[model samples]
Target: MTTASSVSRGRSGWGSTAVAVLLVAVMLFPVYWMLNVSLQPGGGGAVASPWLPLHPDVSGYAKALRDQGPHLLTSLVVSLGSVVVSLVLATPAAYALAQFRLRFTDAFLLGILVSQMVPGIVVANALYGVYSDLGLLNSLPGLVLADSSTGIPFAVLVLRAFMATVPGEVVEAARVDGAGELRTFWSVVVPMSRNALVTAGLFTFLFTWSDFLFALTLTTTDDVRPVTLGLYQYIGSYVQDWSAVMATAVLASLPAVVLLLVAQKYVAAGATAGALK
Candidate 1:
């Protein structure tokens, strides 16, 4: 019986390992291909060497950073601005939702969630008409506002979940000592849900950073285009520069990678906190 159990356990372990390997391959294949193309010399005209990079160059990176200066800067500014604004606006709302049992709280939460379900293109079209009338077309603030609207819902949801884990007694104790709602949130709730805040902030940063359609449609000039839209410019009607496009993609991916690495601890902690509670 012991021998049979050991063999079955070994088979299960191997099956689990195989499943993990397959999942990893599925996720990494596109990234591997992008890197592969970025290193290819012929720029996707025809592969001189199919399997390996014959000659890798940093020229693509240089062009993406130097030649496309305004787009890169615009992406950075818009993404950062959106994330900052979303966090600032969402944090207090999330705390209130989590701590208070206000009338219509469920309805309000449902409304926020429903807003996220609305298609981006639909919102963009409506906003486009409004912005054009208001002279907000081709504006960075307009792009930031659009991104923030989507980001705030998720931020509030995640932060509220984290905030819910905080013991009510602590908040009550602070309030009993004469601390105001803002003070209690800042002093008690904010400090307790630091991990969730970081996780939500990182997510907001990633979403705004990678947004394309809204950025492209809302902004007409290089000064307000995000990196995602800039990538489309690399492709022409007749041909595309695969190497440069891939390099830009790789560079665009780096910020999200760095964000995940930096906030991985927070993500893990927040997830664990939610699970344990």
Candidate 2:
């Protein structure tokens, strides 16, 4: 016993879903092409590739792993490092912002917002001189610090948003139970804000793992290059092997893809955690 308007709404909903699927396919075409090319035999992908890899090959992946393995490891280390540093700094800051009233708090937040508006390249160029003076230029630590500049502010906002909703009574109860600020933060607030922490950390990892500009600007040597830099190594003045290059991209994408899949629920919960509450 559906009305005409309800049937029209159902048709519109199907139309919207179809359009969304088309948009997703359009956006993911490049990724699909990359995988298709990577599976072609004998580096036949240098010129052109078929839509489907009727004849699959693992040589490109083998070559990519052989050549880019170290860089992949480097990216993993830098990404993990950035996450640790960002969360360490951001967690306390977010807690203070959400739980305490400090002077110039609004102004300080405005500053962070403004800093985000500033271009990354400008920040990179500025850090170059400081890094050179401190011997941080071309080092893993430097990359971690530079990448954390992006992560910290973002992590603070996300964590603060979620932490702001923690019931004051719950926090007070923890305090009345003889828990100190540090203990309460660690045992009570942190466990409550788990989803936001995961969300922030996942984004930080993704950012540092995929960072190219910072890798290109802060590092000049192969000693501590990330996979982003190593992937760029395949392309030069002469483009000889496209399959290996595409293969490296596919391999590099795997970690982030797997991480997103694993953390998808936490990310969703974090985003909508306090909305209804």
- Which candidate has the highest TM-score of all? 2
Which one wins on lDDT?
2
Query: How displaced is residue 162 in candidate 1, in Å?
Result: 1.7
lDDT of 1 at 146: 86
- C-alpha-based local distance difference test score of model 2: 0.90
lDDT string, candidate 1, 1-277, tens digits: 9999999999999999999999999999888878877777634642442666767876766766765567778888888888899999999998888888999889999999898888999999998999999888888899899889888999999888888789989999999999999899999889988898888888888889889879877887765678788777765521456777777788888878888988898998976675566
lDDT tens digits, residue span 46-115, model 2: 5577789898888888988998999999999999999999999999999999899889789978888998
Give per-residue lDDT, candidate 2, residue 21: 100
- lDDT at residue 184 of model 1 (Cα atoms): 93
What lDDT does the true structure give each of the candidates? 0.82, 0.90
Span of 10 residues, lowest total lDDT, candidate 2? 233-242
TM-score, candidate 2, is: 0.94
